[model samples]
Target: MKQFDVERPGRAEREDRPITTTTPTHRLLPHPRDLVRFGPHDGAHRPAARVAVSVLVPLVVLATIGHVEWAPYAVFGAFASAFGRGLPRFQRLEMQLEAGLVLVACVVLGTVLAASSAPVWLLVVTIGLVAGLTSAVSDLRRWSPPGPLFFVFGLGVSAFVPATASTVAVAGVVAPASLGLALLASVAGALLPAGRRALATAEGRRWRRGPRPVDGRRTVVHAAVCLVASIAAGLLSLALSVESPYWAMVSAVVPVVGSATAGQLVRAGHRLLGTLVGVALAALLLAWHPGVAALILAFGVLQFATELLIVRNYGLALVFITPMALGMRALGGAPVDVGALVAARTADTAIGVGVVVVVLLATHRLRRPRPEAAA
Candidate 1:
């Protein structure tokens, strides 16, 4: 096992350390990558485990989507399988899932007690799954913020599916199938004795460093906020546009505003410029050939190639994702106007991205001189 030469930073030096833990908070800040390295101790996944998750999760999703009548079961099957596979070695994964379920249960129970609303039911997906996924892919070997993206799934399932006696009965088949598939992969990954030992000793002294305290609630709230804001922005643009309701002018974009004031401004400026560029290019290409499938395919290929380039650069990710997103709507088998919709969508995306930046700036308001942590 090779030792990590770099020192991990303490909580105080890290940017995500709570500035005001004494008060109630709603946002969780992300940690810098220095907290973890590409080593074995923290996020060591056997290639086999990775292969299972990467393959099975998607397959389950496709199944559930195809059987839309069983959306809850389908979604549940997809996520539970993923989590069960990742949980044994990562205690945090279990903790976050349990903690999230508990918190949401309290909220649901409280609502019931209040009697201010209807006798609504509750479903819960583990937020820990999203947290674990991020942790899995992220370079941070140390702790990252906790969030139950799965909770969103739970809400969707419960709100829409109604977990009744019949639903519970159905779950008997679904839960076991989901758990059996997910947990099997994790167990196999853990059983590889050579793999486990290698992971533990892979980063000796660096392995002993303190981990970050994850703000689970913050991550959940902010992620919800971003998603909500994007949806609203998309709808608003739709209302303002000359297009009809069915042609919502490409409103399904997710904005990536800054976490700081300056970052917000930069994000806004970048998106504005990027949108203008995309629209102009789209116009020119559309002009060249109004009925060009080959051009569209070429553009699609270009968009995917650019996504690979954006791996190390988030802003670039947005650039390529934006074009590809617009392309999906543009090339869909519908009687939609290609040029006008593209222009409108580009405009709407820029506006939504601007709103995201402004909101982040207004809220986080980050400043310099916080001092560099160990990255």
Candidate 2:
């Protein structure tokens, strides 16, 4: 780590501190090099496969029992199985449980709100607030999968659920059931050798559970930006008469929250590319008009591929993610509009990416002052 001292307007002389070089300082536009940079595809195969299995089993069971409407709920619950990826067993289990509960709450609340008579603007604001809170929590927890991406996804999807007694009742039942199943899968995942390693890591951390320094201000700003951007994107989507504005909100939050402007720009590009291809794939699949069995299988495979590629590249992940989300929607008994859905997704992503970029540019200079300048 290298120490640096950049000056601030009124701050007292500060002690030497390490400055992260991975992210560039106060850039108005993305560097050209960043646009071409891509993370290596280095996801662990076994863990990803486990996540797919965890999500798949519940979805299959729900579909087989003619509860295809509950498939999305199960998917939300199984989302926890994707956590603790590279962690030891006990830690992984704890991570899964915590994340699962959060997802359950997000899904239930989003569903209830969407089903309510609340104004569309209100719904958008509420979703943004929830996303901010989730972002803060995720940062504090240092969750592996990172950020409020899934939280936003859950809220966005639930926003579409029409407010009805039957719908609410279904949400009440299916949400918890899915969460429970995810928890079980988390425990079962420990049976593998990789799980043992994660357990050992957890034990080591437990002994040293001392506080680790976190940038509260940065976290808050990140959360706030996510909230504002998501809300803005959702509103824009509504203005454009898009059926599901939440997707736009979600697309904005994901790329804009954590990384530098350059990194976000790259990610935004990846999101756009992956989504376009994914939607095309989804259209092809929709053309087949597959039954519940085919949908279930496809969901599992797509999820598996997504987990495998997500960390390496968000764009590639979206290739599978787009179809999986569409598949979930289709199976939920909702009317699938391939053309509208594809268009909405692309448009919303563009809106979100643009909002986040603008926000980052506006706020770049507001970052904490470097001690070097003060000297």
Candidate 3:
């Protein structure tokens, strides 16, 4: 073997040599393995049970009272508490209460706008602006529901309901009913023997609360940009004569609100794929046109399944979510055009994902370079 020079660099030589550092790998999208990984099995059945009860009870009562038109209000209202499901019991309670308040405000506002007989364009603009504002608040507070999904859902669904002076009365009923039931259900879990341990843990942690690190200001900016983009995408759908522009707006919101750029990309893929499969299921359900009782049971089952699968996979959750939403809308008296709705939703989702990708690229370039200290 040839002899090699093994002398180490002198201190002066080492100091003068330019240091080469390894760059941290940051993928613009998740790896295929990341996309499929179901990292942990976190059982969410308790909260699922609560949500099913909360949603179904009010809906059943409204339908029984022949206030079927108001069922959408209660359904949307109850969804307010659907956030914070995985939190420690007391934290979940606090989070849901705050979320419920916000949901009430949003629901009431949507009702007012829908009742105003305003032009559709004005309504879209109003929703976009309100959603952006609410998203900012939600992020700053670190609320679990995150972003403007449910708020926009409430607004979009409410816009379809015939708004009158009586609508305010309906809102009063549904909003309170939703909030109260959700609170009761949320708290009820803590009374369970298993949940009691979590409640105690939360109690100990409650007073120890310190400032949680967050870039709240940056979050607000990102959420606002994302919401505005979603609105634009929704408007585009309307212009293109798509049947359900709101679905596009919702889809757009879903991706951009993800935890990371990689997460967002994964979410966009899940959204598109999930919605495609979901719409197929929805098509079959719509074709069947099941009666009220059947719809109620179906809603309950789907809601349970959605909760069960949500943590396991986003795509899986959407499969149930799509049919549940379509069923709820049909129940709320909106005409269902299964084929057109599915096509429009697919198109809108693609458009929304495109907007998110564009925003991500712009934001990436604008991000200030972090100063790296020498090792």
Candidate 4:
């Protein structure tokens, strides 16, 4: 049995490899240092600032207008700016446009479902389908974050929150405005002299080389994994009477996006550990009982920190992301039982991680070379 490399190729590349029953159990666990280690800065501040401004400006405006209930929709729309982080200006713009469209669609669907008061099962199925579809799309478009995590997240959170005809109309208007702002903010850097000079460099010209041809088979497999993982996590969370089942669904989708089994396990570990610590952070924040304006500012700060740390260390990013997410829910007017909320989120994340781990292991087992074939 060959040892699995931590940085091995993705599942698609390993499908034809000689497999064995004896797995490297050690590789299943991530090194402790890997969890804490941060990668190079690589100008993370630039995109971090873009995403923060995109989210902050809309939130401020909504707060000013005294329509903070619309903040969730705006936040999701601003998510569009988080894509295409390192691409050139034009490519980033194009990617953000596509992402914005997807985000807007998810928000619309979720809002409609919320207004209809759709059942839990229906929400599960709908989000699963969205996960699968968006997974394929992300792969085809070579999205940086890769997978349907944000799409499923947007749809699930929207559907979980209570909505009405009036609120739906509000979402229709607010979400798109936020998206447009995000687009402008994403490319606003181009106006700077430094941005213009960078664009003239070899790295900027690399976009002309075009994206690599997508592998349809791989895309199908990735989509299926995301769909099944999301549905399984959602159903399990519901069975356990978890308050926020979609958190489980979101966590499940995170692991499926990893490049390989070891990578998947690492991601799952990150998600679980991050959420746990984040839950504590969220609890403290909630205990403080920050005012609406204070919460909005905290949300912005957390968003900036999350974007800054995400690419470098996912687990660390979650420390900020968890609180940020809880704050967003509060802004959207979800009744906050601080104890219940944090407990449910923590439980939901654990369930999701467990589901994805089982799925990954089962798939790996099924794909392993048979004894006779090995002979």
132-196 per-residue lDDT for model 2 (tens digits): 89988877876666678888888777767665657767777887787777667656644556544
Q: Please give the distance, in angstroms, between residue 195's alpha carbon in candidate 3 and its true position after superposition.
A: 4.1
Q: Give the TM-score of candidate 4.
A: 0.87
lDDT of each: 0.36, 0.70, 0.67, 0.79
Model 3, total clashes = 0
Q: Best TM-score goes to which candidate?
A: 4
Worst 10 residues of 4 by lDDT: 1-10
- Candidate 2 off by > 4 Å: 1-43, 192-210, 333-335, 367-369, 372-375
lDDT of 1 by residue, 243-264 (tens): 3211111121122211233423
Q: Which stretch of 10 consecutive residues in model 2 shows the poorest summed lDDT?
A: 12-21
**Worst lDDT 10-window in candidate 1:** 245-254
Q: Residue 70 in model 4: shift from native, Å?
A: 0.7
Clashing pairs in 1: 28-218, 36-141, 127-148, 127-149
lDDT string for model 4 (1-375, tens) is 111111112321221211111224324544555556655665677778889999999999999988898888999999999887766766677888898899999998999999998898999999999999999998888776778989999999899988998878988988899999999987676667766765676654344326477657567777888899999999999999998788899999887764446556767788999989999999999888888899999988999999988777778789998998987767755577999888899999999999988887766543333467457
Q: Rank the candidates by lDDT, best first.
A: 4, 2, 3, 1
TM-score of each: 0.41, 0.85, 0.85, 0.87
Q: Is candidate 2 or candidate 4 better by TM-score?
A: 4
Candidate 1 similarity to native, TM-score: 0.41
Best by lDDT: 4
